[model samples]
Target chain A: MTSPKDNKSQIWKKDLPKHTFILLVLLLELFPLYMMLQISVKNNVTFNANQWLPITPDKWEWGNFVFGYNLIMPYVANTVFVAVTGTVFTLVFAVFAAYFFARYKMPLSGFLWAVFLLIMLIPGVANIVPLFVLLKNMNLLNTLWALIIVGIAGGQVFAIFILRNFIEDIPKDLFEAAEIDGASHLQQVINVVLPMCAPIIGTLFILEFLGKWNDFLLPLIVLRDQDLFTIGVGLIYLDGEYNKDYGKIMAAFFIASLPLIIIFMFTMKLFVKGLSAGALKG
Target chain B: MAQPISYRKALNEWPLYLLVIPSLVAVLTFSYFPVLSAVYHSFFDWRGGDAKEFIGFDNFTRAFSDEQLRYSFFVIFILVIANVFKMIPSIAVAVLVHRLVSENAQYYYRLLLVLPMIVPGLVTLFIWKFFLDPNFGALNAFLDITGLKTLLIWLDQTFLHWGVFRADAPIAWLSQPKLIIPSLIIWGFPWIGATGVLIFLAGLQSIGTDVYEAAELDGVGPLSKFFYIELPLILTQVRLNLILMVIGTLQGFGLQLLLLGDSGGPEGAGMVPGLWMYNRAFGAGEFGYACAIGLMLFVFILALTWVNNKFIRVQK
Candidate 1:
């Protein structure tokens, strides 16, 4: 009912501060990163001078990125191998487990799900000491397999939780229709549930990727070999050895962070969508 | 009449069970197995290098009676206060971002907010330590320009010698056992803010627009709408954030180590449970005792989380 003239001015005025704060917040958020980047580009001599801004006539020192890559590349590859293999295993197991939980009236299903809820609440640090012993006993210490196995197990609960919710959203009649066609439960899961839950699965994949990629504490304790370090563990090494080399460390951080940033940028909407959906329900 | 089930019926259902086996094995081996072993180890005096020695309740008694343990608990008590201040800024910024008009603008702000989360704790720890260093750090540089000489000696007790440059300053930050808790709080708060924002943003996105529209029609301004409509709706998110922050703050180590060093700084100012457990097991070579301490923390955290869940019932 407002006049067009009044509405136009009101809308414009409301948006200006929001836009300003948005820009301001974004800049403030990036400040630390900017600092990190500044450190990485400068050489030791320049960095020691403690110049916050990079001055003219100094190398960007792109070698820091290369050095970081060479230092952590094997670890990166190892993480990729672990993550991909773990994700494959996690998704496979979660699908069937979530399917069983959702569709079947199995004995103690409720009890089993309650166990998952309990495990989810307990933070990862609580079990580190015992896990170290268990892995030693199993002769899995310093092995990439240990990391993979642990990541897969830890990753499944969240994936299963989300996938179960997503699967429940599929109309029951779809499964009933497949049943009427003489399809087995296995076939029904593969044919109907899997395809419909693709969005949620994809979302879980990114979450798992970011998580395993950046994980530090577990890799620090579990993997003794320098070669098996993930980006996070590798960065820890960089920090220790070149503690004063802010420039190189910053450069290394930028290089290490790029992949995650790119992946997040591309799949952001889906990430938020899946996360909020899960959050809302929980 | 009931017919005997075909063998195929059992086989068909086996895939479902089969699919969950790997996950179960992994969970049992990595998580459940370790947890139970930790409980078992708590009763022994097995150091990392030595044979396991039975200690019964000795380790538990030591952990409870240790003065340093009592001191860290006091630190955590102070930290809980700092957390209250942090929650206010986090919620306000998150709510502000939700009100922004342009999608592109929101994207930039969100990415900016996410920047801190992406900063690895180890790296950020070192960076902040350098900044907070008593000597020749940027923080002191800024303080000097503003005629704030008093802030310099407060950076550390030994630096108070330079208080003459300040007219009269007391080096207090790392040296004072009492102030170190607040110091730790300052270090921990910014790192956690990003995660808080991201979680809150997700919560905010889920709130119904119709509620906001109705509020606007009822002559409510943006600020009032936020307090009445948005805040209540996002209480679940806030509660979730509190649960996470409590667990993380209780367990985290790198920052404390970075600022206070492995000795837990002067007078054990920055000691928390994680560092305490690490020192006992790794430093003092008391693996069994360390495992006991770790187990105690696990039980404490589990109880806290359970209590929080019970107390914070979501409106929905």
Candidate 2:
């Protein structure tokens, strides 16, 4: 395309500004995280010294890690349970509904699609009142099942919409061929659509998992039991009790962020493929 | 081709209907039911007894007149202004990354931006809380090292208003009423960076390369290219971002609770609608009034979004 790029140095020079800018932006974006890491390593005594430098020798507190884990173990367990159960429930319903929307051109299909869009537009806070009443009347307060059910239901619109978009992109000819081979709709969905929808399904799983994991408001309202609190809820309550305990509070914060950061680091490759991973999912 | 099936015949697909039933029920029961019921709940006054009474127009009037509720709008307004500076920087950084790097490198940066999104909110709060600590914070130390002694008062209201932090020194970070919203704005930058950058980056990716190539051929420089080609292309995204921010402010609760430890951070400067609702229900045990406030917020957000949609024409 240009002077037969024979030298790496020349190519690198041509891209220097862009590269520098990217590095700078990445650092800016990561500054707080770097600070978090530095603080996590240092104890309250070292933090009180008010130095910008990382704990050289005196402030190091690896004990915070063990203590933090012990403190947050139950909350992490609760979070995992909700995220997994919610994802499972959402995936089951979303996949079926997405398949129906994508494959068949039923009457009122556009209207149904519009309904999903409308749901997406409305803020989640809008429904807090009646849902609270409904759950309370049904004797479901402070229960893990309440979270699981509400989370799965609350996230349907975007999940269905995204799954439908991805599914629609799958060539219709493939589904037609399956039908011609004497496959029923369910079989076609399972055999043909499921595999093709893998990337989207993966994206939705992570999205839903993140949503349910980071959810604070719903759980704050519904769950009164400390043990029933998910990570977000648990973290709020934990910090409230130990606000000034910087080492332990920061430790708890670090622990709460650990699972997600780990997942993201491992899955960084997937996010780059133009994936719509931020879409809210049930 | 086979004769077209009747619409009635198509409706007989029991399996299809059955498959959609679970999701339909979930959406209707959880989403639709509550939305309608919130509107219904707004009109009635109940004090948790058999003394339920229809008090049409009363709750709406109260929300409008209530000083605390009215005061929240000013807080929201200030917060929006502060976000502009931070958001502009984030988007500029994001756009610069988009321009300089190949798709692969840009993706890496994008992932970096999303790191905070995945981080639990509690973690972010703690990180910022520590960072903003005036006595031993990296910020104040750096300011002193730079001979900008005024920076020590970065957290003070008097210094913040008088802009004389270096002189008087060491303002209460959370105690001042005027400075509280600004403080929230500063803290919000990192939190917003995670999701805001992602959405904008996605919006940037959707701009067609051919348009840029065409602009280049037309002798358009970088600034012109961004203004003419890129900016207009992402107008819908801007509208989306604004609407999201507005609605989010209306729903702001958890952040304040974490930051201020439940008293709304010095003079109720940081009190927002969502936190107000929480206080009413849980703190004051006025479930009926809280429900009314929640309903009002819902309507207000919906109306705001609808107006924004009308103005922005959400689709290009």
- Candidate with best lDDT: 2
- Clash pairs, candidate 2, are A50-B136, B150-B166, B156-B171
Which digits, one per residue and each the tens of the lDDT, describe model 1 over residues A22-42?
Answer: 556566555666777777777
Error of 1 at A10 (Å): 5.1
- Give lDDT tens digits, candidate 2, residues A89-165: 99989988888787766666667767767887777675676687789877898998999999989778778877887
Q: Tell me the tens digit of each residue's lDDT in model 2 across B1-316.
A: 1123358866765466566678888988888888787677667785444456788878778887889877876776777666555667666665666665356777677666666566676676767766666765555555667866644455444434555364545544666666577678767443345566666666788666677667769899888877876677556666666666667767777777778755577788898777777776667766567778887777778888878778766774
Report how far off residue B175 is in candidate 1 (Å).
8.2
Q: Give the TM-score comparing model 1 with the true structure, all chains together.
A: 0.86
- Model 1: chain B TM-score vs. truth? 0.82
**lDDT measured at residue A25 in model 1 versus the true structure, 0 to 100:** 54
For each prediction, how big is the interface RMSD? 5.1, 4.0
lDDT of 1 at A269: 77
Worst 10 residues of 1 chain A by lDDT: A273-282
What candidate 1 gets wrong by more than 4 Å, as runs, is A1-23, A48-50, A56-59, A176-187, A274-282, B1-15, B48-50, B101-104, B115-122, B133-138, B146-180, B188-192, B205-225, B257-262
Model 2: how far is B72 from its true place, Å? 0.7
Model 1 C-alpha lDDT per residue in residues B1-316, reported as the tens digit of each score? 1113345664555655655566666666676777887888899988654478888999999989988877776676667666767787778788888876556767777766655655555556656665555553555555667856554445444653433233344324565665566567666434336656767887788766677677778999988888887887788788766666678777777567656755688878788777788777657877898888888788888888778778866555
